[model samples]
Target: MAVEVKYVVVRNGEEKMTFATKKEADAYDKMLDLADSLGEWLQQAPLNLDDEQREGLSFFLAEHKDALGQILRGAAPAEAPKKAAKVKMEKSVATSKEGSTSEKQAA
Candidate 1:
């Protein structure tokens, strides 16, 4: 007699995929979960973003809409698109130590 182990991925009571290892199955499940979360978050994100952030995100999404669709649909592209550069903010603060004042700027 032989024993077999099955790693199954089930969604909505239907078997979606099977893997030989638990790790593979778990990774797939996590990916699906993350996609679902991302979809929900994207739907709600615009309301919370500032005008500049929204515009940047919108442009990025437009540029990568096909890749994003493929990812959300459970397909991986051969190469992921490069991320946009982050905007830098500079903050200036003045501090006084022992009757001496100095200003510091951080970016």
Candidate 2:
């Protein structure tokens, strides 16, 4: 059987997380799947801030666009960068706070 490894590339560098058979890697892109799912969840059931929501939506779009580009060029879904993660985390936290504030204000 041919052994395969999964590597996530970032601007600064790259990291290898899992080693699987070539078959397994083709069957499912573990890292991208989680990232896409989380990104979708954040977009669908967003917390509050319209701007943050918009930003998240934009991020989602950019991700998909990049994925499409990769597909066209015969590549796998790319790993999200650290900067994108940091921005998303900050937006999520801000959204949660805004959601709570709105709830308290309403009550």
- List ranges where model 1 is wrong by over 4 Å: 45-107
User: lDDT for every model?
Assistant: 0.62, 0.60
Worst 10 residues of 1 by lDDT: 84-93
lDDT of 2 at 48: 63
**TM per prediction:** 0.39, 0.27
Instruction: Give the Cα error of residue 51 in candidate 2, in Å.
Output: 50
| Model 2 lDDT per residue over 1-107, tens place | 97655543332354433434555553335444555555666666646647566566655655466676656666555544555678899999999999999999999
Candidate 1 lDDT over residue span 1-107, tens digit each? 99999999998999978999999999777766665554556657647776566555655655466788878866575433322112111111222342243233321
TM-score of candidate 1 against the unseen true structure: 0.39
